[model samples]
Target: MPHRSISAPRHRAPALPSTDYDVIIIGAGSAGLSAALSLGRCLRRVLVCDGGPPRNAPSPGVQSFFTRDGIKPAELLRVGLDQLKPYDTVEVRAAQVQRVTPGFQVFEVEAEGESGRTFTVTARKLLLATGVEDELPPVPGMRDLWGRGVLHCPYCHGWEVRGQALAVYGQGKIVTGMALLVSRWAPDLVVCTDGAGHLSPNARRRLRQQKIQLNEEPISHLEGTANGQLRHIVFKNGDKLARHALFVHPHQHQRSTLAEQLGCRLTSKGAIWINKHSQTSISGLYAAGDITPGPQKALLAAAEGTEAAIAIHETLTREECPK
Candidate 1:
């Protein structure tokens, strides 16, 4: 048999007359980058627009991602960009998408680059890999400690602070559930209602049954190290609790309004609704990552992005190259 070098076949989008692309992915986080990798490999011209400041940018390291665990978030993104260097069909830009308008057979995307220059491009498909923004609690020092000693997603940061004195801070019914989740990492867990006192008697009983302490006193402020490592939480009544880490359920909103402006439906949780293939309610528009309703994680978002790209490629093939 003739020896054949097993090289990855390079695929490029057919040269179109206009400056348009097969797909334009907004927010070049894990999901957007992963989607671009798949689409580029399939010969689709992909453009990923990353505005700035990723959701996990404040975090020192990304956790729970297999093989790349503990790598800094920015480094992970840099690695992803490096991996895409071989795919000539894929390009990344640091720009903010201002608007997306549907066209005859494409979508018009207007974006502003860091150099204060504006540009527009047309794309056959749009992928909203734009992740959500974490709205931290208003408590003093809380925002500064986000993604550090103050964190969310126990599965993501739990092991890092395992066995440390952990505190869950929030109000209303959600905090009760959060307390239970945080207990897995630190048995010595405390739930602070921040003076809301929304927990029912039954909820209090449940916490006590699990040996979790419940504090209704309003939090005065959070005391942490200069580097964002939480040390103590002071109460309004002059009481202080020593805690190494605080788990919070911070409110989150979509980072970009482009999806909403495009008329895609959102979930009750304020996430972009997508089908199993990651297609949004609008045809030719897709979404993935934290913007979708699910337990948000880096690996999960990457997988969802891959799925959305495959679906987009298949749809385009069926429409453009029918048998």
Candidate 2:
């Protein structure tokens, strides 16, 4: 990533100043940072307000990012921030955005920091890259082993859990699909519906033909070893089935509430809808990353951020702001 030189001298804007920035980006995760890098190169005065909670905070490492696979989250951000420093156009504030509103041809941003200080930033445009969170199953011990023994995103953690005893805890058609896909990695695989009738007859037949066991009994809870490794699953019938790892498809929710509050169009699946140029229905407002409906991958999120930044630049150019 190359930094964009500031076309003009750096100057500090007043705190809580009304409508003063070219663009105010929220969240400093992969997507947010990527957007910052792009806009920073264009010499756009960009402020990134982060909630400090990234979507992949629980994951051990990032996956599927070419040439940067398995990189730690902190390390990735460090490199990204370093690259953005020379531009002097991107400022990352460790704060939580409380609310957003349209004011006098710009957007007003109200945010609070850990020090109990609240500040407001006004920008001509707003880009929301706030990512989503994984909604884990309400299973005892599941929370403790999440992102370790139990995981979501096969592409991210699948290689680590490969060749291990695996189980897919899901219902409906998803159970069979997950079981078969996981079976490719783990020879020993089981599909546990946990008493939910989600497996169709065709799916059941396929699993049986593949010699995979279909566990319909309800699961009471999961048991982990002293070292915190998942050891056995406790069924309501008092059966303790030994398993090394479990795969699940968790429910996902967007991180930013301001998008909907501002009346941006949303997809049927609850994601903010954006055009190919990353522009939302609301002019001068954009979104990227896991906030949009798609597979949640670090690379995809980063790419979406880049796209949004380019669109923002074009929009800003048309407005005749100094670049």
Candidate 3:
């Protein structure tokens, strides 16, 4: 026993538990890709998980994006992804994030693959660029005509259908405001409140002064041409409202509940509540793009992402070298 001494067991250095990536951007739309570009330029390790096609995938083209206006949504995203190639530290993957678990210093994320498999990743900070989804009107053909005829956001699609016969679909003050805003694009605009035109006295007076027509008949279903152009809004009593396009301020919902899961505060409008630096209620958790408050434009979202990146970089710098 004295001659044959047991050797000490060999052990590899414990794997580093710190995050391999500084940020894990949960969506790869305009915001996520934009943030990744900025962070990547800073030489930070970034992993961008592209859930799928962007929320604007149904739209024909992106508008108001400088130098890239009218570009198709997929093309714009492809360009964003291509532009990131120069940054070696950036990685992009297709993932539908399912769960997030915030830990001591890192957040664990699980994404489900197309094959029903799941993978987990961790990061020091998380950025949720997961935009919102438009819940279209319950009319029969609304879904099919969304982004084309049953539209949202006058600034984005209004130019294409400008001066055409347009109708605003919704009720209450929201639709009243939408009708007024849409009037700028379509002089021949009509406000179809479906059943009740809940316009305020001021709103109704404004509509009358503006010469915007109101239709309160309960809608039967929407009718669109074979080419996807809206033709008319059919009423329950066989009455038809001929229109080329319908502007809708449909209810919107966040595409991902990650913000809710991570305990980020939500605005009354259902957007993620972020501080000036784009950091969410929970420290180290950031949000940008349509998920945040205000308007939802591709250009605006990209700008938000860039701002968030700058803020995240500054925060990380402060944490590392506190003076």
Candidate 4:
């Protein structure tokens, strides 16, 4: 019964201030921080509350992002904070939000962090930049190899494993698509359906034409070295397949429980539903990033962040002037 020590810490929110902020953004990841930068430029009082566990923290580096492609997550975030520093209106706090409640003019937020301290702040508007969690498969040893030899985004790590032996793990029709796409990087690709039904005739044809192995055996477990680098895949039949890397299609879930707790309408995939203005069904509350229940990608999350900030800014102006 011990918690994982992810980082050394001194987390404490300053005493609850009396003034109401123009905006309060929760979950300081790419989306939350991006929105804060935009609102700060407008001289809005923006408070960013960070719980500090990012979904991509396991990945070695971020890719496909313009200008900063392949940069470490910490480095990217550090540079982001430096850029946002000039905007004096923004304050970054390393605190965990406990709850959010609608108030008369805005909303009330309670946050607590290390040192057993708590602070409350009120905001005229709220933005939920909470992201999503990758629901990994229940396979043993796979979790340890995640973001190292096992990955999700081919666009992110395909180059790194190009020409290596790769395995695509999924079921049904999805595996067909993953196999075809992943074959671009590695000619030695295996489609592991985990004892699932066979692919369609056309699907099987496409895979063979691409020279990808269609493997229907159930996965007994993943084999890795003592250091946790994946070396091979062990099947239920006691056969071992050498695999340099793996591609998994994990189910995703939203990270923000507060949004659901506050009654924000969610998508079928459990993402927050927002309009063009990024306003959710709950007025004064907006959401961005993977938490919104759609396909998850970094560029898309950042775009949603910027859009939410703009929408919040407009609402602030209208509410402040009452015109």
lDDT of each: 0.90, 0.84, 0.89, 0.85
The sequence of per-residue lDDT tens digits that candidate 1 reaches over residues 133-163 is: 9888789999888889899889889999999
Among all windows of 10 consecutive residues in model 1, the one with the lowest summed lDDT is 10-19
Q: Output the lDDT of residue 107, model 1.
A: 89
Ranking under lDDT, best-scoring first?
1, 3, 4, 2
C-alpha TM-scores of all predictions: 0.93, 0.90, 0.92, 0.90
TM-score of candidate 1 against the unseen true structure: 0.93
Highest TM-score, which number?
1
Q: Write the per-residue lDDT of candidate 3 for residues 88-120, one digit (tens) a residue.
A: 999998889999999876889889877879989
Where is model 3 poorest over a 10-residue stretch in terms of lDDT?
9-18
lDDT of 4: 0.85
Tens digit of per-residue lDDT, candidate 2, span 37-67: 9999999999998788676765677877888
User: Model 2 clash pairs?
Assistant: 172-198
Which candidate leads in lDDT? Answer: 1
Q: What C-alpha lDDT, on a 0 to 100 scale, does residue 80 get in candidate 1?
A: 92
lDDT of 3: 0.89
